[model samples]
Target: MMLDRSITNTLWQLQDANSRQVLALVQKFELPEIVARILVTRGINVENASDFLYPLIKSLLPDPFSLLDMDKAVDRIILAITNNEKIAIFGDYDVDGATSAALIHRYLKEIGINSTIYIPDRIDEGYGLNTAALLKLKKQEVGLCISVDCGTIAYQPIDDAKSFGLDIIVVDHHISMESLPNAVAVINPNRFDENFPYNNLAAVGVSFLLIVAFNKILREKGFFISKKEPNLFDLLDLVALGTVCDVMQITGLNRALVSQGLKVMSARKNVGLRILFDNLRILEKPSVAHLGFSIGPCINAGGRVGEASLGARLLSTCNEEEAYQIALKLINFNNARKVLENEALSEALLQVEQSVTLNTKFIMVSGNWHQGIIGIIASRLKEQSHLPTIVISLNNGIGKASCRSVPGIDIGAAVLSAKFMDLIIEGGGHSMAAGFSIKDHKIRDLHDFFAERFADFVKEKMIKVDGIITVKSVNLSLWNQLRRLEPFGVGHPEPRFIIQGVRIINPEIIGTNHIKCLITDGNTTARAIAFRSVNTKLSSAIMQSGVKTILGRISVNYWNGREFVQFVIEDLMT
Candidate 1:
């Protein structure tokens, strides 16, 4: 159900000549002129068009040693490996942290170091490193503790680990604070003064650097017995999953990670991945869509609704039976998550409609929402209302909130304001997404804080569209044209098209509440379906309009082996 869309509606007209210009520049280097224009409009030009369009291995990859702490991080890890010292990995329960933990653990084991893996339980303990877990590692007399995906934010936790007489090496990719933590090596690209080539690497990418450095150290120590230092590109499969699931921008290194990662995933080396593909009925050749919607969610489900360790174990294990068991458990958890997400989203939407006069650019919803699924719910609400949203789950006297943002709104900035004024107990994230905690009674203060800050920022902002297109461009060729922009996300989003004045025929229902129709914009005909818009004004227009229909920012789709375009229906003018 893809469409003939442009990156910007006004930048370039959808035509074959422009597409051929784009095609001649890249591997898909021979697409329609409209595609070339869309690609160009999405910030791809003649010089870098080939790179963006193809995402080649050489072009996307950066030098492994480009990071500042690469040598230090590698030397220390290699020393630990040589001494046969016991190493424990401390990781968060989220997908990024879990996957990074698993990736590092797998690489270590492959190099014959059976490191002890420790993932903090979300239900029992909170996000970052807990003192109790460190004490347990102390009891085990572990020599080194490698912190993955987290710990950059934990000023006290790192200090505590050191006080407990433990050696710590932090390998994370989260935004950092001004003061650094006390550790043997802190390998984070976001560290202040870091001129690292790419700040967009996920935690897994950071872990990959440690692996690269360790290999370098090993080779320097006369242990060089590798074919091109063991292609780390293969690990992109894990990298892609974590990057996408964690909701990082798809530009620079992050884009390369997913682009190459998708290729490895389609090959399906990991047994647990094989089961996931088999059960989900995903084809051998997976796509960005498959990774984003299919694989990422199932892995995230374990952390959100079940055990975060489940995803890590699944990715790390070689035991087929264990992998299968974990996959089944994750799938079941994902199923349960869907129902919970539906209920929470529905309630949030209803509340938005009821409060039509809320004078704020951001919406904050607090209730007894499930803490694990709050982030996804926040994302849904953000999309549903086109406003920054924070969904908090209150338990006892404490509340945990997950935030999702919209264009022109900095949710992170909003959360930071609440934190600064002592409204929220703790808060952290980027401009677009964030997480926070507040005392039960402080919810109102936090809301007012966010509302005020958002209002101030709103005056200087506007809706930032990714790219635009139209319905007439829908064709078999455009499907492949969209493929040129593989691994679409945060920064490089999928192409969105605006199709208006299209006639609808025999509007039959599909999905739980969807529609199947023939959408004809006179010269071009595309099979269009609308999801969850069955009874909305969009559906009503298709039903009642005597002439034609208007469409806006619609996503291309394919269902039951048939291609089509679908509209989100921004508005209708008849």
Candidate 2:
């Protein structure tokens, strides 16, 4: 049975899991009933249950040559390494790009090759390979240049580079067009002509495969006999960081990479990551959450407000002192970014309340906002309004827009369509997010275009409850069983359960927007926190007295050298 729409405007319904299948899983795997139920709901059968629970890199890693043009990319990179040609890595300014650039740089450094890492400034160079930047790299005598996390559709700049006698290799994961760039190799899984099994890989994942293939070729050629071979496993930490930050689907090969990378991260082998963790007082072992929330933001802050190349430099640097200094800068930049983001979000929220109508399928707000923080603002607005949101920063008659979308709506494809229709300048992204540029005069046209395009869009807000449990069930054993589904993100979300017959006790505002309180189900009481619910209907319902029901994910909160199970409240029923 589905419950009525909750205070958060979402219908709560228990997910369908076959009881017999759940029981079979519990019997065969000796798993907790709750764990088995979750596995069954997620489409895990007895045959693939073991692999789902324990994703190993060696077993899950795909053949490198499976990707189209991987052989060409590997061969070109190997030729540069053998000839000792000067190489330059042009990467995007975001965390994925930074991690991808660093992974390649570290691998090259291990093989006694020093390559220059170039991350375009967000303000100066918009995105991808610019003709000027390519010319600059060419003037620097960089014989081989590799672009990561971007350059899938950089036809002009790539053509320009090719004309100037610069050999370019595009190692990216963005959706590609019909015609390929004029590069040595465009090794992307999402190529229209490619038939790679798994295509949801982050750019860093593609870069890792390139190196894996390159290393294998080197070993076969006896190049590694004279020098110690670089352990590619040591680079999984970067891959994990990029994968989580990019919000890629954590399944199949990605699951294995992240599951193993988290282990490598715990070892603190990367000097820069080690120092950053020390500075942040991250004493506990790193998890997917830590990478996404704590480390990813700091790394991305450099591209947002500080130096664009700081993240790559920090991840690739070998000096401890330099790492410490860069980590401090990143932390400070992140703090500054938060302030700017909050300010912009407040402004955007006000605009939404004042101007948005129920008929509006999506929210588009333009202002003199910081281009760096508009993406965050778009995400915040999307979360609050539950619609596709576009936050644009206007500068000199041009608007730079960052879009975040809800489920069932492909904002990236819409943006690309708008680009094709000449409503915007240039834009491309995945399903859930995208970015584009539009002339100020054409903002209205773009809005009308999106409105007509999404005229049939209807957001049916529904919250899937994994299971129903009492407050008494929130304990260490259940939490431990849930840990088996670690590293959840994007496609594989953390399970949320409905806790019925509960009372809210001592609801108080914590930090800025978080509601901290205690929940009691008659005999047992537990701590619960609702994040970013201030002045909202959910917070209002949570503050009221008497019996209540909440839908939330169970998590362990560590404080004062102790761990406590906490209910991270997501929604509440009246």
Candidate 3:
């Protein structure tokens, strides 16, 4: 039976079946009904629930050879490893790119291969493989160049590298074109001609597969008989960080990778990561939230506003002092990025509010905003309006735009179409997000094109609530039980529940813009906080209501070494 409820006037959607099988799961698995309902909603059954709760990397891992061109890619790398060729790693300047490059570089270093890392400047060189950089690598005597988190669509640059007598290998997971690059090998599950099962894997995830295949071949060759083998488990920390930072769905192999990676992170083998955790005062074992919000932001700060290579360097460094210095630098960079992001976001919001084309289904804003901060601002605008948002920052006679889309919308495809039609200079991205560049004169055309594309798109706003329960039933044990479904991200979102018939008392403002209140059922009182809800409709409604239905998550909160359960309110229906 589906429990119907509404919060903030948005319909509550439960993305799973409501049937007797939920009770059957509760009885068979000895689970709380709420937990069983969540599992049932996700289609977790008796056969896979055990594996789902305790996913093992070894079991979840697919054969490396399952990906297309895996053999050729491994053969080329093995040749480089044996011949001692100078290899160069060309990576994008984001967290996924940095971690992907670092994962390969670190793996190579372990197997006695030294490789140089190159990241293109976001502003000057733009994204993906560049001819100038490839030529520079060729002149430097680098025999092979490998592109990570990029190069799936870089046709001309790979051709240029081949002409320069430099062989290229592409290990990426981006959306690929029909014709593969002219590189030595292109190992991407998303390639048009390929049908790899794990297309959702992040770039770092793909890089990890290369390392696995390389290690297997080397072990078969008895290379490790003469020397101690590098423990690949230690590298899970990097894989976990990259996977979460890229915002991939935490399911299947990704869940196993991040689950084990979190354990590796707790070991603190990566000096740079440890230093970052320490400086950030993260005393507890890091969670998915810490990785996404705290550590990932710091690592990405370098690529966003500082040196593009700094992030990879920080992640790859082994020196403790150097790690500390880089960590501090990243902290400062993150601070600077926050300031720029705030300014750009404010401007973008104003532009959207005052736009003449405000009647369009998608929000489009263009201004003299900071180029680096437009992506984050576009995401914020999308959340605020529940519509696709495009934020363009004009520089000189050209404009660069970043787009974020809601569900049931394909902003990236629209941008790609615009690019193909000559309405934009260049753009390609996945369904949820994308970026592109256009001439200043084409801004109006781009807006009109997107408006037309989204004209038939119906906007929706819904909150998903997993279950309805009494606040008194929440406890630390229950929180710990729910955590079995750990490393939650895009696909496996953290569960939210509804606690109905709670009286709101002593509503007060807390740090920044959060609302703190005491929610009571007249038997037990539980604390609840609505983050960033100040001066909003949610806050105004909460202030005026005496008794309300609280829609949120139940979590065990540790305050001053005391542990207790509290309601983490998401929304309220009065």
lDDT of 2 at 522: 77
Question: How do the residues 1-574 of candidate 2 rate in per-residue lDDT, one tens digit apiece?
Answer: 6878888779887888899999999999999888899889889989998888889888888899988888988888888877878999999999999999999999999998899999999998997889999899989989999999998889999999999989999998887767788899999988879999878999999999999999999999998888999999999999999999998999888998998999999999999999998888888989899998899999999999999999999999999989999999999999999999988888888889987887889999989988899988988888878899998999999999999999878887898788788899898888888899889999999988888988899977887789999898788888888998887887788999999899999999989999999999879999999988999999889988988888999888888788899899999886
Query: What TM-score, computed on C-alpha atoms, does each candidate reach?
Result: 0.88, 0.98, 0.95
Query: Which residue runs does candidate 2 get wrong by more than 4 Å?
Result: none
For candidate 2, give the lDDT of residue 74: 85
lDDT of each: 0.73, 0.90, 0.85
Maximum-lDDT candidate: 2
Higher-lDDT candidate of 1 and 2: 2
lDDT of 3: 0.85
TM-score of 3: 0.95
User: Which 10 successive residues of model 3 have the least lDDT summed?
Assistant: 1-10
Candidate maximizing TM-score: 2
Stretches of candidate 3 above 4 Å error? Answer: 1-9, 14-20, 356-359, 556-564
| lDDT of model 3 at position 483 | 80
